[model samples]
Target: MGHWWDRNIIEPGKLPLLLALAAFVLTFLITRVVTRLIRAGKGPFGNVTAGSVHIHHVVPGVVLTVIGGFGAVASGRHGFGPALSAVIFGIGTGLVLDEFALILHLDDVYWSEAGRKSVEMVVLTAALVGLLLAGFVPFGVNDLSEDELQNRAGAVVSIGVNFLFALIALSKGKARTAVFGVIIPVVALIGSLRLARPGSLWARRFYRRRPRARARAVLRAYHHDRRWAGPRRAFGDWLGGKPDPPHPLERD
Candidate 1:
């Protein structure tokens, strides 16, 4: 075990990354627990306020992120400084991303359906970082043989092709696929080859003239959402908390 750790983690200079990922996941979980408790009115924790304004955690998160980011840059790799800075950055990232919906919408949507994006982003981030920890290289470069890498042109072409597929997937509204595809090119290819989601850029531009294709795309999207939306929402609610009920005025 120690040998594996040293060879795969320490020797490879992945300790700080590992530490950062651990800190990031832990901080996010703790933040969710605290926020959930506050929402339930069962904890001493409450919103932070200054004067007439309510200060959000994102403010402090920004400060810490800047500090840790700079510190990491100055500290270099393979040291206590890097490890400490990584942890600080991870904590700050957790706080910032916890309220990503607020930043995105420029409003406090923490308990709204839109707020689910934050949890999804965090989950996606953690999964990607976990893949990195598992030594999955970006752009499928890791799959190339040493001889292929030695051919610089070939490597560049391979990466470019992978990037093209990823872009196509993104345009098709396969965000998760596009993101993961950066590390696993086959996923990107699959997403790119699949039909675009209804209302996606690919569907809007390409399927607009094809009535049959448009209908098929819409049908597929409906079925897909129906199959996963409930479980997805349930998981998000369980991990974060149930969103506040919508107001009549806010409803159609």
Candidate 2:
């Protein structure tokens, strides 16, 4: 055991770690971008951003999964095993959170959106719990070949997450948006492993498809609001009874 662990499993490679770190940084930036794009205003980007509250939150989870997966793979552990499993865990966990959040009415403070999110969250959360426990638990790192476990876990988690996301997206879709989002992630998640490429490649491409116009704008707004605190910001902060910074456009 020690011989194999030392011989085939542990290798000195900074490439994977570098790659994972890059993915993490990219994920945070990309998430901010997506959030901004959605929140910029009521054009295509703004609408997408608002609607994305339903899907966009998964971006961080997906990013983390890829980082973990690639790190495992780069460590000279096994075929694309750890990375893939991590992806599954990521997507699955994201989905579970989304669904549960919605059902629990944690989607927002507003009553209407919260109601909708609560119901959706309940149904999806139940489904996710059942699927994950039954399918993904056995495919741990210590058990199967690295790639096999990763593939299995990735597939299970992605499917579970996408299933929930797809349900919401499709049911309330605008010209099949859900289908497009699901396809992009699915193809990228599965295909990247085969090429021994990191999943962040897909995430980067996904966000890159449209420049983060809204995100950039929102960031600008956020900064502006921070510099010049005003009446509206004060009122809003008071109303919310929370010392949160004002949104840029919300300032005045």
Candidate 3:
């Protein structure tokens, strides 16, 4: 285990990245716990307010992100300075992404259904970073043989094909698949072969003339959402607290 860590992480100068990932996940978890406590009114933690306005954590997050980003760039990849800067950047990222929904809608909706997007984004970011730390290279270039890498044409062709698959998956509204596909070409290939989502650009452009294909796509979407939505929501709620009850007008 120690040898693997040294070879895969230390030798590759990935310690800062690992530190950043750890810090990001830890900061998010801590922020969630504090916010949940405030929501329940069970702790001394309270919202930061100034006069008539409430100060969101994203403010400080932006500040830290700027500082850490520049600091990391200046510190270089080796030594403790880079690692510390990485941690700071990670913390800033956590705070910023926690309020992502609020930024998107320009309103306070922390406990509303819209706020769930923040949790989803956080999870996605963490997953991608984790994959990177686990040695998955973006654009599927890591799978190339040494000889193929030396052949510039072969490398370019491989990358181009993989990128096409990712693009197709994105057009089909398979965002997660597209994202992971950048690191693993097979994932993108699978996504490209799947039916497009009903509301996606691919469906509108390609499935428009094919009524049967459209119907099948819609049906697949419905069943897929029905099967996974509940578990996905449950996991989100477990991590970020359940959303507030809907308003009466919304229910109506």
Stretch of 10 with least lDDT, candidate 1? 71-80
- Report the Cα lDDT for residue 232, model 2: 44
Report the lDDT tens digits of candidate 1 across residue range 175-249.
999999999999999999999998899999999899999999889999999999999989999998899998889
lDDT of each: 0.93, 0.41, 0.94
**Candidate 2: residue 178 Cα off by (Å):** 42
Task: Compare candidates 2 and 3 on TM-score and give the better one.
Answer: 3
Model 3 C-alpha lDDT per residue in residues 1-252, reported as the tens digit of each score? 999999999999888889888888998899999999999999899999999899999999889889889999999866789989999999999999999999999999989999999999999999999989888898888899999999999999999999999999999999999998998899999999999999899999999899999999999999999999999999999999999998999998
**How many clashes show up in model 3?**
0
Put down candidate 2 lDDT per residue, 219-251, tens digits, no spaces. Answer: 654675577656544543332222324457767
When summed lDDT is taken over every stretch of 10 residues in candidate 3, the lowest stretch is: 75-84
Which of the two, 2 or 3, has more lDDT? 3
lDDT of predicted model 2: 0.41
